[model samples]
Target: MRFLVTGTAGFIGFHLAQRLLREGHQVVGIDNFSTYYDPQLKEDRNTILETYPAFSVERLSLENAPALNAAWKRHQPDVVVHLAAQAGVRYSIEHPQAYISSNIVGTFNVLEAARQHGVKHLLAASTSSAYGANLEMPFRETDKAVHPMTLYAATKSATELMAHSYAHLFGVPTTFFRFFTVYGPWGRPDMALFKFANAMLKDDPIEVYGEGRMSRDFTYVDDLVEAITRLVLVIPSERPPVEGDTLSPVAPFRLVNIGGGKPSPLMDYIEELEKALGKPAIKTFLPMQDGDVPNTTASPALLQRLTGYKPETPIGVGVPAFVDWFRQRYDL
Candidate 1:
């Protein structure tokens, strides 16, 4: 299979592209290497991918439609995975325009490219944050996600709507997967696991938000990649819908939650990190910031029904793997 995956330099994209390359598939990666976190880390990931003969990359942003279309025309990929976006809830509070441009305009371009190129299947990344203010435990894909708390969540939800419209009008098959709190090696710096590990290593206090009462369905990167890999073959159609499926009634589009349906407490996650790092973290309990949800848990019924798999990596194994990678990468 030939795959064109955006944000190949990002954490999940890197892992997904690497998995595809290992399976002997040709992958054309697209990344602008934005300094959202550390460009050096992005470069390191790209450098590793460059060694694979079946992998190639284009240095461009998804907001650039001309360049993106050019890449699509050049590669003529069989599948498209859109993952690039301006991520981070707290960051969106200060820089709202960035979210609009990257998440909105960027995803718009990807949808256009996929529509024009007649790709077989299109897979894009959404977030669990879309289930904002619903107060619904174990969010399902069919639940009402009308109230988004932040600009970031709003943009992601908008992406889902736009993709649905395209799938309806243009006959493009699309699958939008809402991710839980994903954590693992090569994770984003803005994520909780990375922040806690970094702060603990430096002997700094880790900020415990929501007054230490938050919980999340933390999915490991490898598990996410596996689910996505299997889902690439489960393209949506007008056939009968599976039980608990979120398939659109009018279009060949679907929404699936890629999680384990297991919500772990925030304090328990920190404890796992402490155990992995062999040190206790100095904790600073604080109120939950605006646009922050107290808890999020995904119902993985649809994902399992479609892919026959679920994200099952527990924190005990995942946290230690990340800690080991952090130590070797930074020599701490």
Candidate 2:
């Protein structure tokens, strides 16, 4: 299968591209290499993908609709996986415009390109944050994601609606998967695992948000990528499907949750990191900021019904693997 994947340099995108290439699929990728964290890390990830003969990378941003469409038109992919976005919860607070441009406008461009190209399947990334302001445990795809606490989440949810509209009107098969806390090796530096590892290794302070009173699903990158890889082939054909409790019924689209199914406490995650690095972190307590959810748990029943798989990486095991990579990468 031929695939056009956005954000190939990103955490999940890089892994997904590599896996597709390893499985002998042709992939065309796009990334602006923005310094959301470190451009070097993005470049390093790109290097791995460029080694494959079936892979090609185009340095571009989704904000530029013409350029983005040109890339998509030239690639002529059978399936389109839109993973690129300005991803961060706290950062969304200070830079709300970034979310609007990348998450909203960028997604609009992807959907437009996919719609125009008549792609068979269109898969895009959404985040657990979309289940904002809801105190529901194990958030299901059928749950109402109308209340987004952050601009980032709102944009993603809007993207879902946007995609559904296209699917309903134009007969495009679209799948939106709301991802939980994704962590693993070759991960983004801005995430908790990477930042905490750096701080703990250098004896710096690791700020505990809400004094470590949060819980996250913490889906590992490998498992998340697997779910995505499998989803690329399982396109939703039925329009307005029925889901338990919640789901869209007018469009040929459904939002599925990709997670490990367990919400581990923030303190327990920190402890796992400590054990992995063999160093206790210097902690500083901080109050919860705006646009922050205290806990998130994913209900993967619909995802399993579609893909027959779910993320199951425990932090205890994933932490050590990541710490080892951090030690090898930075010589910590």
Candidate 3:
């Protein structure tokens, strides 16, 4: 199948595109290489993918409607996976407009391209943060995601709504998966795992938010990609009510949670990193920042029911894998 994936330079995007290419699929990737984290890292990821004959990349942002439409018309992709976005919970509090432009406007452009191309399956990335301000233990796809604590989450929720509208009005089949805390080798520098790993290697103090009380279901990147690959074929066809399905009543759209299904404490994650690096981090406890949630756990029932798989890599193993990569990458 021919796949056009946005954010191919990003962590999950890179991994997903590689996985597809390894499975012998032709992939056309698009990324603006934003300075959100580091363009060097994005370039390095693209370099690796460019080595594959089946993979090709275009340098452009999704906000560029003409460019995006041109790429869509050229590739005529069988599937479109929209993963590019201004991603950061805390960063969203400082720069709300970035979230609007990238998450909102960027997603809008992707929807328009997909609608025009009449793609078979459109899979977009959402976040567990969409379940904001809800004290629920394990979030389900059908749960209310109306109360987003952060602008980033709000934009993602808005994208889901916007995609639903497009799917209903234009008959575009869409699947939006809400991700928990995703981490692994080639992870984003802005995420807690990368920040903690960098600080620990330098013997610097790691900022423990929520006084080390926060928790998250840290889904490994490879596992998330596997779920995504499987979901590519599980496209929604109609609005038939199925058990554990979040299928929209009016469109060929559904929501699934891609997570580990096991929420780990912030302190526990830190300890795992310490173990991985063979060094303890100087910890600085701080109150929770704005637009941050204390804990997030995914039910994963819908994902399992749909894909027959769930993320199972625990922190103990995943953290060490990332530490190894960090050490090799930085010559630590």
Residue 256 lDDT, candidate 2, scale 0-100: 80
Residue-by-residue lDDT tens digits, candidate 1, 153-260: 999999999999999999999999999988899999888888999999899999999999999899999999999999999999735699988888999999999989
User: Which candidate, 2 or 3, has the higher TM-score?
Assistant: 3
| TM-score, cand. 2 vs. native | 0.96
Cα deviation at 156, candidate 2, in Å, is 0.8
Q: What is the C-alpha lDDT of each candidate?
A: 0.93, 0.87, 0.92
TM-score of 3: 0.98
From the highest lDDT down, the ranking of the candidates is 1, 3, 2
Q: List the residue pairs that clash in candidate 3.
A: none
> Is candidate 1 or 2 superior in TM-score?
1
Model 3: per-residue lDDT, tens digit, 274-315? 988888899999999888889999999888988889999998
Structural similarity to truth (TM-score) of each candidate: 0.99, 0.96, 0.98
Query: What value does the lDDT take at residue 151 in candidate 3?
Result: 87
